[model samples]
Target: MRKEFLPFARPSIGEEEIAELIDTLKSGWITTGPKVERFTAEFAAYVGGRFAVPVSSATGGLHVALLALGIGPGDEVITTPMTFVATLNTIVHCGAVPVLVDIDRATLNIRAEEIEKKITPRTKAILPVHYVGQPADLDPILEIASRRGVAVLEDAAHAVGSEYRGKRIGCFPTTSVFSFHPNKNMTTGEGGMVVTSDEAVFEKASLLKFHGMDRESWKRFAKAGSPRYDVALPGFKYNMMDIQAALGLHQLRRLEGFLVERERLARRYDEALAGVAGLILPSRVPYPVRHAWHLYTPLVDIDRLTIGRDRFMAELKARNIGTGLHYTAAHEFSYYADRFGWRPEDFPEAHFVSERIVSLPLFPGLTDGDQDDAIEAIRDVLKAFRA
Candidate 1:
């Protein structure tokens, strides 16, 4: 057993990030200043987005994006049940109902064909999550939304560097929101970005993110600016800070290197874990795309073992190998269950994967020795727990 405990994820922070943050602090203008502006512009260019609005979190970004598109009370948003509850919570906060479509068990993404069947007159948008950094089939989903006169919002929280069909994610005609949390591919401490090509949506989202103020803080307080500002509408305080963007500026520059390292570790896991007893590895779709490999989640085959998923995780923990549960089925939560009267069988694929899924460690800084230790630990646990 290893003497050190290995975490499921860790940010790859470097000296450049630290230096930029120190510079921002010494500049005496920390809250949403020049750093934030530069990061937003660079990020927009990187993602090929016409506009990018920085926010406090991905959850906040989703809320603002939904409101920007005029989604609200009595409206329905179609999404997958296999994602984090924030996806459903944001819709509920907007007084919109979340209509869940079961995920494809292999890809863990919402099925495009099944989406149309759930669309009603009240359906305003389709929010497809790029599950585990693999982009959901977008072409068909976009066609359905266009034909139905509804919108599409991408939950790209786990897909910072992912690509689908020869194009990067945010470059598409629709909108996408990406997370910059510590565990994500890159870190801005805790921040997110809403990327969109729609000029109208961008304008509305910008207004909604920073307390509905007509002028941003940096502009209002600048030498050639007026201090007076006006609030056009009620909005939340969800703007990303300059301090956060300080780190983001450097992190963005190093993202390509981070992606290469993550892919290397993920492929190592695949080679070691393939056909391993009491475990089912993640599957790839039959299309041309680049998976960001944010999390290398596998199903613990509980039926073949004396231990259940939780117990299996406990066994790994005992060996000092940490794990993570990316999500439980959204419908299985008490709030959604009580509100929608949903049962596990309502979304069978999501339910099955929810019960069995476990995220093993996969991070940019994970060394080969660390990964080998984790792999050996998993095999040991499976061998001991085999029924």
Candidate 2:
């Protein structure tokens, strides 16, 4: 048994990130400034996006995107219930109703075929989450959105480096949001970015992200600038700070390498757990898209296993191995159930997957020995449960 506990996820911070953060703090202009602008530009270029607006969180980015698109009261946004609560919460925050669709059991993403049936006059957009770094089937969703005149806003919180078909997740025709949370493929220490190819949406998001300031305060307060600015409309204070952007600048530079290491570890987990009974591993689509491998989640077969998901997780913890629950059915949550009148049967696949899913430890810095320890722990737990 391992002597120390392994966390389900850990951020890989290096000397460059530390030095850049220190430089930003020492520079005295730590709010949304040069570092933030540079990071946004570099991130935009990295993902082939026309514009990228850094925000406080993915939830904030989603809210700003909805605001930019004018999604409000009486508007309904179609999304999947298999995603994090923030995916649904942001729609409600934008004063729009969150209508859920079931997920494809194999990929754990929203069922693209069911989207058109959910479209109504009140339906304003399709919010597909690239669950666990795997890109959702987007071609059909885009086609449906185009024909129906509804927007497609991707909740790409788990898909920073993921690609759909040949293009990156954030490089699509419509708007998308990418998170930089500590557990994500890259870290900006609690930040996100909104990417868009639409000029009107870009302009609206830019204004909405910073207190609706017509001119950014950073530019106005700079050496060769005017001291005044105007507010076009009421907006939220969701801009990313320079302190966070300083870390993001270096993290983006190292992102590809980080992704490579994560993929390696994920493949190792797949190999080690390949024939493990009572476990269903994640699957990928047939297209030639790169998966970011944010979480190496596998579903436990409760009918075959003696212990349920909760007890299995506890056994792993007792053996110094960590695990995570990526999500439960968002629609089944108390608030959504009461407010949206959602029942468990509304999204059967999401509910089924949610009950059994467990995120194994998979990060850039995880080692083969660490993985061996995790596998051994799981094996021992299963043996004990079966005994």
lDDT of 2: 0.91
Candidate with best TM-score: 1
Clashing pairs in 1: none
Query: Where in model 1 is the C-alpha error above 4 Å?
Result: none
lDDT (Cα, tens digit) per residue for candidate 2, span 14-66? 99999999999999899899999999999999999987889989989999998
Q: After aligning candidate 1 to the native by TM-score, how far in Å is the CA of 11 from where it should be?
A: 0.6
How many residue pairs clash in model 1? Answer: 0
Tens-digit lDDT track of model 1 for 161-256: 899997888999888999999999898999999999899999899999998998997898899989999998888999999999999999999999
Q: Judge candidate 1 at residue 274 and give its lDDT.
A: 91
